[model samples]
Target: MGERTRLKRILRGLERRYGKIEPPPKRKGLPLIVATILSQNTTDLTAIRAYEALLERFPPARRSRPRRNLPRDSDGRIDKIKIRMVHVADARGEPNWRAIEKAPLSVVRNCLRVCGLAETKTRALRSLLKALRKETGGYSLERFLAGCDTDQALDKLSALPGIGVKTAAVTLAEGFGADLCPVDTHVHRVSGRLGVVSPSGGRNGTFRELRKILPPGTAHAFHHLFLSHGRAVCTARRPKCDSCPIRPDCERRGLEEV
Candidate 1:
């Protein structure tokens, strides 16, 4: 079969196996961004715990305590005071960016240590948060990503102290659902096994080649789907080839042998 035909088969089989792609849980922007950073070289469960712990320690609104039942105005309407009260109260007990910003590096590092990549990721997280505060005037993650294209976003994120291509792509894919593929170790390995790209090339080549082959708007979903499939079925050590939905196409391509 032609290379293009094989790839089309692979994509269709993947869709059959995984069903339609769903957006990951919608989380507040900063925490989601932090969690994506922390997920580097770690398991999802571990990353989630670390993210929750960090948020517990440093909620997004730390400047003032939340108030309840403010007095009404002469019109008997709960005015701006009530609005602020509601906003604060709703935000009460959530992660505060101010607290995170003010936290000692050691504390921040320790908090992230639980997620894995303690040494490297801590520095990245701290640097990113610091830059966010300095550059954006606050922890406005939406503002930070605003007006940036996928490539621009990737460049901006990878320019941070410890963030790299994989981390940036993952963050953008997960945090903003941007249309970019994140070729991590798993995606790289699995893509090679499926003969989508040559095994001789490294992750960068695989990313570039796959980016060329896949349809433009679906790259983000395809990235997540590939990662999830890698974790769930196409594992590194021993892929469940027999049970895989794409086994026929893979076998035809000698992917299992590879």
Candidate 2:
């Protein structure tokens, strides 16, 4: 069978075990961005708690920075450096852009502390939202993307502070239903070991190669299968390869314990 056919067969095998793949009822656009940020290095439960806390702090009519150029001394050395004046405000209606843009840094940090790297995440959240405001004249992520071409959309999303290629690709796949998949640790490691995708070029390269080899509209399901299988059968360590449904297709199967 062709590689794409093998991929489809793999998906079918996993689906029989894991059932359907469905994303949760997430708040699209801005909220989706926040959730992705919160899930950076934390567990789902921890991230959810932190996200909920943020919502409590910045409610409706509210919700949710300017950079100053540094002046150098005559020596062209750092004599006096200006601190970035973090802007803050209180929202009146709902947790909206106006509220997030005006909220103080401390509040945003505290709200997301449980997710770890609160300070960094808070800054990213603010930076993206502010960028959105500048681009759209308001906070409409869908509209912003709808107007931009695929490459343009990916570039803008990738340029965001906390958004890496994986996150940006995930956003496109999950949020916009694009025919692409994001490779997380599970997907990357599993793909590498499966010998389906090359081990070089890291996760980004794997994403590219997988996109080329896999059939259209199957990237998301392929990603989901790798994730579920990676966790349950073909794990990074102590994998249950003997019990795997697709072991015959796994070139490096059980190499985890070797």
Candidate 3:
């Protein structure tokens, strides 16, 4: 069978085994960005805990005054308000990003210590927030989210500090429900093993190839289902090929020794 046909069959099997995949509720802008960054190299549960700790430690600040008569910055080049007035309450009262930007690195790192690469993540957070403020005059991604060009939006997002193609694709996928498949470890492994895509170029290459063949409007489901399959049945150490729903269709590449 053609790779595309096999992929469709595998999708059906995965859906039968795991149930219909639902797109997560839309989470735009900063909160989604922060969550994505926190999730790096860590389990989703651990990332949640770290994000919660961060929110608790640096709770949302009181709403800023109206922007009708906004003030200028120190440089006085623009009329950008020193405080972020918009989108502050969008996260059901998101953590005070301004506080995070100014907080000592050690303090922020402590909040994220539960996750991997705490120090690196801390620096990234600070740099990311600051860069957003400078670039957009606030901690907001509405501009990218609202853009008509997907590639342009991806480029802008990927240019941010500590964000790569995977992160950018994930942000667009989860945050705005964009038609982009993020190639993480799970997606990379599962797709490769299933023979849907060659893994010769690693995650980035797999991502590019997968996008070319992914069925229309199925990126969200494809990502979630493959990720679930990888985690539960096609695991790295000991995949349960015997019980795998897609076993019949999977190539089982690199599993002979396993």
* Clash counts for all predictions: 7, 16, 0
lDDT of 3 by residue, 47-110 (tens): 7678778878998767433223323447763222121111122333468888899888889999
Candidate 1, superposed: residue stretches over 4 Å from native:
1-4, 23-28, 62-94, 251-258
RMSD of 1: 11.2
Candidate 1 C-alpha error for residue 54, in Å: 0.6
In the range 1-258, model 1's lDDT, one tens digit per residue, is 487777667667777776666664433456555666777777655665676677667755444443334335679754321121112222332467677768787887788878777878877877888888988998777788799998898898888898888777766765677776789887887788777787677887887788788765677666756765777678776677877877776633334434
Q: Highest lDDT among the candidates is held by which one?
A: 3
TM-score, model 2 to reference: 0.81
What C-alpha lDDT do the candidate models reach, one value each? Answer: 0.68, 0.69, 0.75
Better of 2 and 3 by TM-score: 3
Clashes of 3: 0
Q: Which residue pairs does candidate 3 place in steric collision?
A: none
**CA shift of 175, model 1, Å:** 3.2
Residue-by-residue lDDT tens digits, candidate 2, 1-258: 587777777778888876766642233556655676777776545665676677677766522311222334588742221110000011111255567778898988898899898988888889888888888888878877877765677788988898877767766766677678778777888888878899897989998888888887788777777876776677777888888888777888767665
How high is each candidate's TM-score?
A: 0.78, 0.81, 0.82
